[model samples]
Target: MNYFQPKPISNFNATIDIPGSKSITNRALILSALSGKTITLKNILLSDDTQYMIKALRSLGNKIEYNESSKILKIIGNKNPKYDNIDLYIGNAGTAMRFLSSYLATGTGTATLHGNSRMNERPIKDLADSLTQLGVKVEYLNKFGYPPIRITSSGVWATSVKIDGSKSSQYISSILMAAPNFKNPIDISFIGKVVSKPYIHMTLTMMKDFGASFTLKENSINIVPKEYNLSEYLIEGDMSSASYFLAMSLISNSTITLNNFFKNSIQGDSKFLDVLLKMGLTILDFKEYSITVKGTSSYKGIQLSMNDIPDVAQTLAAVALFATTPTKVWDVENMRIKETDRISALKNEISKINGDFIEFKDGFLINPKPLEMYQGDFLETYDDHRMAMSLSLIGLKVPNIKVLDPSCVSKTFPNFFEEFNKIYRED
Candidate 1:
């Protein structure tokens, strides 16, 4: 029952390093397990989500060693992952649950993949349906679209798959990762316009890094079933988290430097620099690995569609509230299905602050105005780690905010409050 009380911040400082990205780390771990080669990954985020994936991988007879001192991961590949016929618990990691869904679909034995109470609620039928079409026997223990089910990987699969990409890219990524391992090459077509296209690109790029090949057509990806050979991989720093520090710099005139982050990262969230640039922030990149963002006086609000970088939507929305004018964001419908219904949650809190915000089915528009500060009330996290942390960025301006269920941050950034307090001020 730990709660985090917000401390107002006056001037934020320069230089802070967030851990390696959860996205890249999880992707690397899965690729390493599927790669059929010994691989070493440096600067990996050892959070709860990755830990769950590591446990699941080890349970499947793959050898995985994580070094805490150097933050290095050494992996011994498994050609045939020995499923011990145990229930794999993924907690609340959507990536772990989704990637594992596809990874185990290629296994020889029957394996069960499910998560916490929230995991069962998250929709996984999109992936399960795709796997079913590919000849994988996927059955739901409870509901058709939910988890807590049995997946038995048995026979040769389809030559191609028609996937509805409009819902989630994780569903597509899951199918794509396992498609190459199937007996047949997979061609994926979209049921509607694809959402979060960058994540699909990230999946493709990582697959290519492991010697996988593909041909992406107008609305399809054609890939021949092949092996993924692991090589040395160093994950990029989490710019999704870095966006908070970047936003802190913009709001508080702070100059912050982030390390091990590439300007040319395949991650779409790195494009947040362009968004901040539009907000009249000063950013200079000495090289791809290092950047300095300085707050400037030209901060003004503008409309943005952050569909590509949906993970940072909460932070951007908070930043918009502090902007020089009103802001509007679009293409966020997919965010509804995340760890929480983010749009509704933010609206509920903003209303309490006397803020002016308009919510839509897919997006929201907000006005820049001074709102009521947190009045020592208990703030709900909705079991979403980002919801707790992203709103912490707002805590710099709003005081007396107590975040209930503070430990929920362990799902992604475990030391969120510690890192936040390191940058806090007494007003």
Candidate 2:
């Protein structure tokens, strides 16, 4: 259970094929399930978060046949959805909880959407309140704005909603995904800043691809409900998942291949490549959907504002260690509400290495110029998968860097350490 130990290695170099994207995988799962058609999903991630979704879907009466040989997942649409009195446990995936909140609210039966301890702690009232405005009765089982929500779906509830977009895109995407049932499409207007705009775009694009109709302008999206013709949906590899390895080229100075990446991916995190590029990493396009990353012989610091793709903050923090100058990331407040308080966690742990970091109003600035190796110490992962995996990069170049709860990577990458060792082993 304690995977903590100092690992020291020199000259990290290897080509790695990262796992499927969690964001893309979850979207495909929900879309396939809703379309009531079998979707032959490719490169589905087999992490705990995804497995939790798969298991929950199976309980909801979806038959998923996974072919390990080719990494294809065949999700047999529910010929008869087993809503026969069951609670869908989403664990800690906010995406699962929010999207499903809007999704299951249209079901005929009463359903409960809930998760782990952290789930109840995380806010969902914004999403729940929006559902309620549309006649979807979402009652909080305990604390308001949190989970353990009770939803009793009647029919297609079409009511336009206006909400603050600065909160989270999952709220808006929730409305869009569940709007297909209304005789009148859901009309949503944003009241404040829209964070994670790319993800909202992704939802619209996916819905459009699946035959649903929608229009997005500025902060408003008009979704016209139509019967989506179910077909096989194959998702490209997750760029977020690939970011670690792509970043490895910079941190480890290795060549890594991230296969099946989409040039036009619905995943907002795909911008990670561009971010790394700004940091001086280059990609050699191998095939149409695959590329190899060759790091620049030298490193340069990049000061970026990560409001759009905030999830990569941890990786960027890790990447900062190799930069010639200090890297300052700003306006990433959303990182605080993720699996853990990421901003604080990043600062707390990074300080242990060299104690050379500063926290800004919304983000952190890492000064790796003073980074120095220390005695062997186990870095606690705080049950956050990103924190665990991101810390591993530091160990590649620094001695006595141990990672605790390395298994926490299963939240996204189940075989992270194994693959890490594989990509890092000396020839």
Candidate 3:
């Protein structure tokens, strides 16, 4: 097992550049492949998840040229691509698994979507049921309502469908991205309160940017059949990836400026800055395309619902270790189904450091402990990227904290440690 030892930094004023959004890159890849027009994407993230997405699109007969050094991608979209049979390994990429499930359903082909053991356990039944409702043939190859499933489609034949949105927003995004390929105009309605509502909005906004005609109401969305049109698109920096460095500022006495982070970012995780601000994090500068933040010597605990920004909830959990009071985060029951059971994982690791963590079905409460009382030689990452990155925060103040399986960060941020190491003093 590869272990990473995070050392405390004495001097940590630095500027860092984060990679493109894994969320946006995967979504853009699907949209570009369906556009039937050559599209250029700039500053796209080159990571395991996106590589899986690009490979799946290529396997579906879309021609794509990627320049890793330059982070540019050129995709030759194929609107009516067809395949006889293909097996795609999604490797725990939730976005790719969910997004591609619908993308494949909009084409004339038979495809099987499978993944690693963890991915196989993640739920895909809600998406499957919705596609089946739209007349797509969906079969559970192994356990019902999970991956290792088969999808055979001539195209979407239904005009309207209702899906349970409480589990994952990816289900809604999956159907929305594939709706334009439906035989008739589609109406999508939600059954319950949709978690991560901002992600659905991001999908609609990007669809409109690609020339899709859609109307979004309070509880339903109407989509018209139209080909996506876009010649060039520039992906924004991943705000979720930026959260670690932002949290780094809060743990250590330092200032960090992150490039390519927009003040008006459409990513839901960008709102993490607001949560940080509430914890006494200061924003030194906020511009259209960049943000500078300074750390505090002490932080205030916060109580709030993180359902909208669940991705950064782990970051907040780590930051809570240094808070003055107990931090309460709830309304993120979906955390149980991510790359790992984040709530349980966070609770387990926090206990190792003498921190008090009260678990709940939806979320947890974290009580701050004295830094001198912090004790733990190693923290298990559970093969989850967020766990590895977020738990490393404890090392910023505590001594000799080693994170096991740090390489798990390759899922979204491959060079997370490399960038994270930049804050250390050369001496």
Candidate 4:
């Protein structure tokens, strides 16, 4: 097992220009593909997940030109998808898998979407079942309610459909993005409380950006079937990746500035800033495109409902270790179904560092620890990018900390360690 052992530092004060938002990039790809015209996207992230989405689109006959060095992506949308009986492999990219399933279903072809072993484990029945309501033929080629599924649809024209959003908001976003491609207006009604509401809002915002008209009601969204307007767009910095640096600043008693961040961002993970402010981190200044956070005082642990920002759950877990009181993280049961069993991974890793935490089915309570006890232990990452990135914050203060399978971060932030090392100041 390969491990990365970053040297401990007393403090750090640096600026980091985080990469573009993965959620936005993938959504833009789908929108651009549907636009059937050339759309330019700037500052796009080139990672494992986004790459999978791009590759899948290319296989379906979409024209995409990506400049790696410039971080620009230009896609020529295919209004009419070509080819039949196509095969697409989206490796553990839940966004690509879910979004592509619905996107391809609105076409006149039979496409089989499969992925890595882990991808097949994620549930897709909710999206498939909802698509079926819209006159799409969805079949489970492998297991029921899972991936390795096949979709055969000449076209779908549905006015209204109900989807359960408790498990994942992607299911709803998938249907919403593809709604505009349907033959008629589509109304998506939520069966119950949605888990990640902000992500759904992001989808709505991006859909509107591409000229899709949609109306939002209490529990349903009405999207008018229309062609997406091909427009140039710039993706914002990833707020989920920013959480690790934000937590690093707090834990190491240092200040850090993140550039290319928006104050009014569509991403729900940006709410982590509000959570940090409540925990006593001082926001020195806020600009239109940048925000600076300083370690001004001791942190107080407070209970947080993380249903909306589940990606930051691991980040909160890492920060909870530095709190003066126990931190209660609740309403995030979905973390159990992520890249790995994140709840169990967090519990096991925290226990290895001598931190006290009570694991619950829904969430966990993290008791305060002065600092992670350094025993030169190899912290296992479970091949989950968030787990590796979030837990690496311990090395900012604790000694002899080594992160195993650090390469897992390539799934999103390819140069995470390199960017992290830039902030490391030896004193």
Candidate 5:
């Protein structure tokens, strides 16, 4: 097994440019393809997840050209293409699996969506059941309520559907994006308190940007059947990716500027910046598209509900180790069904460093420990990208810390370690 040992820095100062948002990128791809018009996407994230979305769209007959050097994509949308028995391997990308499940069902064809071992274990029943309500034929190929499911559909024209949103918000976002293509106007109602509400909002905002008409009520969203119209769009930098570096600056007592980060980001994970402020990090400057932050020698713990921003919850868990008080995070039970059982994974890894972690059903409580008292030889990443990136922050202060399977970061931030290394001032 390959391991990466992060070297501690004595004087940390660097400027980092984070990659594009994965959530926005995948949503834009679907919107662009559904539009059936030539669209140019700038600042697109080129990672395993977005690549899967791009490849799957191409397999479904959408013409897309991506330039890695310039970080741009040219997509000629494919409307109502027909194919039978097509196989798409999503490879642990939860967004692609859920979003494409509805995307494929709205078209006229039969396709099977499957993924890696962990991806197969993640729940898709909420999304599948919602699609089934819209008249799409969904069958469980292996395990019921999971991936490797066969979706056969002539087309869907359902007017109303209700979905259980407690498990994931992607299921709802999936249906919303494809709703415009449905023959009849649709009313989507939620069955429970939706987890990650911000992601759903992001989807709606993007859909409107693409020229889809939608109205938001207290509990339901009504989207009129209309064609999308978008010629060009620019994606913002990923806030979830920025969380790691933000925590890095704090633990290492350094100052770093993140370029292309917006002060007003549509992503929910942007709330992580507020959490950092509570933990003693100072934002020196905040421009429209960039922010400079400086870390402190001491940090404070905080209590917050991460239900709306579960993606960055792991980053907060890593930062908790250096806090003076116990850090309490709750109301994110849906995190269990992510790329891994993130709640359990965080508990297991945090224990290795001798930090006190109390695991609850929904979230965990972390007791702070002094940097000198923390000791661990190796930290296992469990092949989850967020796990690898978040846990690596501990190595900036604690020595002899090695991250196993570090390459797993390619799932989102492919160049995470390269950017992370910039903080280490060479001897």
Candidate 6:
């Protein structure tokens, strides 16, 4: 295993420029492809997930040009697509799998969507069933209700459809983005509680940005069928990536600034700032597109429900190891089905550092204390990018910590370690 050890140091301070959000980039690609016009995306993230999305879109006959030097993606939308009966492999990109499944189901011709082994295991039934309700034929190839499935395109016909949103919000977003292509106005009703409601709103807002209008009434959303307006869209820096720096600031008693922070952001992970503020970290300044955070000598801990912003749960778990009080995280059962079983991975890795933790079905409670000894010398990341990055924070306070598969961070932040080292003050 190729592992990289993050060297611990004092006086950590720097300005971080996080890349564009994976969620936003993938969603923008789908909306732009649907608009059938030239839409340019600025500051787009170039990572494993976004690459899969771009590859899948290109295979569907959409013209996409990406300039690596300028960090811009120019997409020529295909309002009417003539896709070959090609099999697309998305490699664990949930957004591309879900969004493209719906997007291709509306156009003519057959396209089979598959991915890496893990992606093949991930649930697609909710989105599949929802697409089926809209008159799209979704046939499972390997297993029922999972990917490696086939979608035979005809056209959506249902005026009203119901979907279960408890598992993933991408199901709702996928359907919402494809609704405009239907001949008639579409009404979508959710059967259960919507997890990550902000992402659903993000999808609706982006759809509106592309000239698709929607009205919400109770548990359902009504989308008007109209042509989308093609225009340039600028993606904001990922707030999920910012959580690590926020936690680092408090842990090291250093100040850090994140450029392109976007105070008025659509990302649910932006709520992470509230969690840090409650823990007694001082927000030195909140600028329009950036924020400065100054750390304190110590910090307190509290219980937090991370249902809306579960992506930051691992960052909070790592920070909890240094908290003055026990930090409890709740309403994150969905974390079990991420890139890896995060709950179990956290338990296994934290135990090695002598951190006290109690696991629950949906969440965990961590009690901070001094390190006794390491049961293991190296930390296992389970090939999850967030796990690798979050657990690396422990090396800042604890010694002899090396993370396996550090390059797994290419899933989101490709230059995480390089950029993190920029802030490390060696004296």
Tens digits of per-residue lDDT, candidate 2, 1-427, equal: 4774535543445656667778778777877777777678877888778887888778877889998878889987552243655788988888888877666765666788889998788888777777777777888889887889988766655668876656688888777776775657778888767788888778877788778877767767777767666566666777777777777778766666666666777787888888889888877665667887777656887898899998888888888887888888987887888888888888788777764678875799887653354333577788888898788877766777889888888888887777677664644
The RMSD (Cα, Å) of candidate 4 is: 1.4
Candidate 2: lDDT of 425? 68
Better by TM-score, candidate 4 or 2: 4
lDDT of 4 by residue, 311-355 (tens): 999998888887889999989999988898899999998888787
Give stretches of model 2 more than 4 Å off.
4-13, 78-85, 370-376
For model 4, name the residue pairs that clash: none
Candidate 3 lDDT tens digits, 237-285 = 9999999989998889689999989788889999999999888889999
Write the number of the candidate with greater lDDT, choosing between 2 and 5.
Answer: 5
Q: Put down candidate 6 lDDT per residue, 211-304, tens digits, no spaces.
A: 8888989999998788889679999889998889888888777888888799999898998988988887789899889998988777887897
Across 254-281, the per-residue lDDT of candidate 5 in tens digits comes to 8889997978899998989988998899
Write down the lDDT that model 3 would get.
0.90
Q: Which regions of candidate 1 deviate over 4 angstroms?
A: 82-84, 371-377, 424-427
Every candidate's lDDT: 0.80, 0.76, 0.90, 0.87, 0.90, 0.86
User: What lDDT would candidate 1 get against the real structure?
Assistant: 0.80
lDDT of 4: 0.87
Candidate 6 RMSD to the correct structure:
1.4
Tens-place lDDT per residue, model 1, 141-256, is 99778988788876447887778867788888887776667777778877777888888899899899888988978878898988888669988888787787788778766667
